[model samples]
Target: MQQSNAYIITFSIILTVILGLLLSGTSQVLGPLQRKAEELDTRKQILGAVVDGETLRKMKANEVLEYYQNRISSIVVDIEGNKIETAPDGSPMVAEKVNVGKNYKMPAEKRVFPVFIYHAEGNPDAVESYILPVYGAGLWDEIWGYVALKTDLNTIAGVTFAHKGETPGLGARITSSDVQARYQGKEIFDETGTLQAVAMQKGEGKDYDADKHKVDGMSGATITANGVNNMVKNYLQYYSAFLEKTKSAKSSDVVALN
Candidate 1:
């Protein structure tokens, strides 16, 4: 039996409306859950810079959140490194909630950078390390990470990285534990007091001297490595003012003690 054109058209329209409503209802039900999962993963990555990846992986979701809440403190700063409590629209700015990828699209001077301070366990007053977020272009998509610095603010204590799309064995290795460990104990400043960000040289299997500001290059991932180098260098430069101010305050304290 052949259906009338009007009947077919009405049926199609009704089906489309039903499908749209179903999708909207699903989104409403899952939206908060999805957001919570993303927030948890972000916290994990940020903490990974200072803590062991294995430790993070072993913990439950609530444990991770508890650890972050107890030990981590953060602040948002502009390119000039001045603390910014309110966003451009006058809303309160939360450091953990700042989207680095979105900020990367805006002009550098207009972007707000988030700095995470890892406090000593059970002692919030004592500072342990500082973690800075970095983002940049990768070979196929975007890459980003958190870099933790020691008390001096020049030594890289640890790092944790992730990418949107990269080759499995090549560029994707940026997230590998071995690759991240290479940055441990690396110095970001030279003896001349200049901020010379640590770099990943070209090619792999080449040893770099410990005293130099370079790390082992990744095999078949030169572009990704370069992106990491540039991202770290640029973000460090952006955060230099805050670093300098912190250093000055430490110096003043030392003088007062003397």
Candidate 2:
């Protein structure tokens, strides 16, 4: 078989084009499913902040999505605590579209905040909890989590932390039930009603004044603990407007009744 260099080059070019097209087609076909899975996983993580691990383990993807849709009501707000449906130019203010990682790099004044309110069954107005998203630097890379606050907005109801590359036996311990449980009943506000983001004190937490906003840090993860401390505080400040507004309304109601 005698083939000129030009002929060989043409054949190779055709084969390359065909392979590229096939890959593109495959990606087109699978893209939606992959995105669907990712969505379900995110919903699961958000649910993890509220539901128990065992209960979540028994649920399927559709169930997770349904749980999110039914139990969670959400809003998108800017740094100033004003509700935004779209940008100042009138686009849809999609809560799910904001990327915290990207927003983190932007100036604080330019960041958009998303708030998720979970309501108990059959209670439309009675908010079960307020779930806040938080992320920041860990010892190695980035770490993030969801923290659910009681209606009082000061007491922590539940917390779920995850990290990109924290130390397994130390920093990564934040994900442990025992570690997170320490946050339960901890207040994020001081006696004077000031927002005092919860701190992670070194030790067994027995030394920490939990009622006054302190949690025990991971055994040997001081830096990671500090990251969590800052993360929670940052989010607390971001959410202050909504929290304070609700707190004031409830307090006013009590005064009227008395």
Model 2 over residues 1-258: C-alpha lDDT tens digits?
A: 999999999999999999999999999999999999877876776777788867887998888888888898878877767777886678877666667778888888888888788897656577889888887998998988889998888888888888889999999998777788777778888889888988888755465652568877777899999999999899888879878777888899889999
Colliding residue pairs in candidate 1 = none
RMSD of 2: 3.9
Instruction: Report every candidate's CA lDDT.
Output: 0.92, 0.82
Worst 10 residues of 2 by lDDT: 203-212
* Predicted candidate 1 versus true structure: per-residue lDDT over 138-212, tens digit per residue: 899999999999989999999999999988999999999989988899999999989899899888877786556
Model 1 misplaced stretches (Cα beyond 4 Å): 1-19, 209-211
The count of backbone overlaps in candidate 1 is 0
TM-scores for all candidates?
A: 0.91, 0.81
For model 2, state the Cα shift of residue 203 in Å. Answer: 4.3
